[model samples]
Target: MSNQLVAEMGVVFIEDSEHHFFNARLAVNGKPFTSLLTPRRIRDFLERNNIVYRCHKGKKQVNEEKQMEINRAVARHLGCLKRPFQDGSPDPEHQYNMDESHFVIDLDDGNPLDFVGAQSVKYRSIVSDRSSGHNNVRAAKGGSNARILCPMLIFKNKKSSYPILNLPDTVYGVYYRSSPSAFINGRLMTEWLQEPRCWGHAWPFTAARTLWMENASGHCESEVEDTARELRTTVRLFPANATEKVQPADRFPIQRIKEHWRRLAERRNIEAIRKGDWKTGSASSGKLANPGKQLFLNLASECIKLENEEKDHNSVDWAKKSMIQ
Candidate 1:
């Protein structure tokens, strides 16, 4: 009989295709059924059996079947990259990741005081305003060997300046620019590609290196690829819809940076409170003001260090997930 017919007949003949569900694992020693049933058949079987899908921990909210296929693609891609050196293994130092992270300034991410079981809570900031969320600082980070390649900070303005008196940092200083949205663009990406500090850190000019980046519209533009070719660099894009699982930088650094930035924001808030900066005049008046652009710039420099990197992964097989933690 067709699998669809068998499932609809309620014969209990189908095992979960996801193969990760608790109930499915408890059934038949957690072994997947020999027959590969279509997702429609599996869904029908579950619905008929009164089984409902439960969100699993650490799993994204994508269609389970689609996620499974994505995982397979991730494994194949990583597996191909993991072959021995004689068979073209990637040089850890030359294998780099490039990505952009948008940061909001003068924003308090702290949870406001609320009573237990309250359905909702709201609090007003003494200095922060609604407009703070729209203004972003885009940090373009290049990393390899768990080290940052001196990040470039893009601010949301046609023109702006930093308050730091120092000309350059002794270690891992910053490169700054301006964009209307404080986000990356094709021109900005091309500019980054041509920066000597970026390529110089990896090798002599035109020395071959592997760059892993997302297939975003901006990065895939002809100009960006053309610039990379001039530098003797090869760009490999992350598999579609699988960056969360396969991107080392996305898989790790962003969370660490966000946490550190939060701490900095909190400390700044406390200082402001102590100095009565929140009090505009006779009393704390007006919206709470955000920290200046400098805070965001400092954040980019601190984020690319080895200590800030992901250090505690269980080293799950790369082919099954990612090559790095």
Candidate 2:
């Protein structure tokens, strides 16, 4: 009966009666039963089942109509939908998906290892100076041609006194502290979109391009829209909470870049240990060396190169089914 009640709770019809039935079954078995279910016990059960709770405050709510509109807009932009406004959708080469992701200098949480009866373990690392580092990456692929734009890296530093000397000339570095959040703001977005390096090399002669991005405040600014209009690029905003499902960048490219970065960082740490650059000490005293800005640039560049090479191998598949294509 307890099992039956638990199974019923997993279904869609859980209500007061279900709870009462569960309690009655417990009472029949001469076990303690209560009128109200304990939240703590419920959470414990969920945790045992590998389910975690997250607070979804201030999340954008998209109605069915809005979602449908978003779908139609995306289809039209991809040349899959017949619409007068989208008569000549830009080819894949000219269509780009852009997004920003934040990475920390240190691991956010420690990894699990083979251990027995241990309360905790400690790993030493340099005190992270910058907790918020932003990378704005753009991925564009059309048929057999795929181009990964040189990413824009934003460090948490004053714009005037940013340490430009620490970075390589190949990677674009911006020193702007984002307010209230780790992501970039409207002014910075405009500045980045206006940069010649972003669009000049990819489509030098083609004025008409399409940019798909999430509906974040930074991406939806009036200035950003005006700049896109001036540059002859149409900006399309994805529906709220829909980027992970629709945006190609979010689907694979961004994740690949971060994975590559993690691997590179691990290798760098190993090399540092081998070279005695990293100091060894007790858990409370040890300090691990942090990769500098130049290393970050190198990792980002290598990831881009790797993705570009992989894209070449899969270009035929992409050409046939890619929405951007």
For model 1 the TM-score comes to 0.62
Q: After superposition, how far is residue 69 of candidate 2 from its true place, in Å?
A: 13
lDDT of 2 by residue, 41-157 (tens): 654565566544222248677899988887776665445433533666446556666777777755423232223344445544432334435454454544445556656666555
- lDDT for model 2: 0.56
Q: What digit string (tens of lDDT, one per residue) describes model 1 on residues 248-273?
A: 75554556666666655555555565
Question: What are the RMSDs of all candidates, in order?
Answer: 17.6, 15.4
Reference-based TM-score of each model = 0.62, 0.62
Task: Give the candidate number with the greatest lDDT.
Answer: 2
Q: Give all candidates' CA lDDT scores.
A: 0.55, 0.56
